[model samples]
Target: MQINCTVIIQAFNFLITYLFLRKFFFHPTVQLIKQKDTAKKILAEKLKLKELAVSNLVAKKNSDLDAFRYSISQRYQKPEQAVIQIEPNVLSKQEVIVSPEVIEECKNSILKGVHNAL
Candidate 1:
């Protein structure tokens, strides 16, 4: 069997190139990918925490509003009066008896060709 000098040189060159790439390029790239994944996980956890905090704040606000409404109803001795009045009359299910002032305003708006006051 004849041993070629070029074959040994080629094998040595391949090994050196592989080591250099592993040390300087491949290892750093792998570490950077791992760091990016860690960052994404940290951001996701923080976002979840923020979402929970916002939900808690909303729930607190709703409870406070309900308490205020209840207090208003007790003070007025009328539960229905405590409800916030809707601007658009058509959307409100409760039938409000038209006051003479409101009827006059509606009649004036209709005569003026203004459709929004109804």
Candidate 2:
């Protein structure tokens, strides 16, 4: 088979064009795409770490709140228990009986105050 000059020239032109496009355009675009992918992976890892930190913080706060509530309940309960223990003793004290003469004197004083107000 005889080779044509036009076919060789066209093939050479295609090879040169392909090499130039790959060097200037295709390679840079591929590199940019790879960089973006790496950045996305790094961001995802950072997000997972942040979520884990938030969960740990929430757990610590919950435990602290529970401890504070327990301490407050104990503080209130001690006074309530003391008051309950002292209430019976206070109620068991004897009643005093007033003399008839003293009762009559108080009634007379009250009546005098009412008359003066009128």
Clashing pairs in 2: none
| Root-mean-square deviation (CA) per prediction | 15.6, 11.5
Best by lDDT: 1
Expressed as tens digits, the lDDT of each residue in 3-96 for candidate 2 is 9999999999999999999999999999999999999999999999999999999999999999999999987764222211222463345874
Error of 1 at 39 (Å): 0.7
Q: List the residue pairs that clash in candidate 1.
A: none
TM-score of each: 0.62, 0.64
lDDT of 2: 0.83
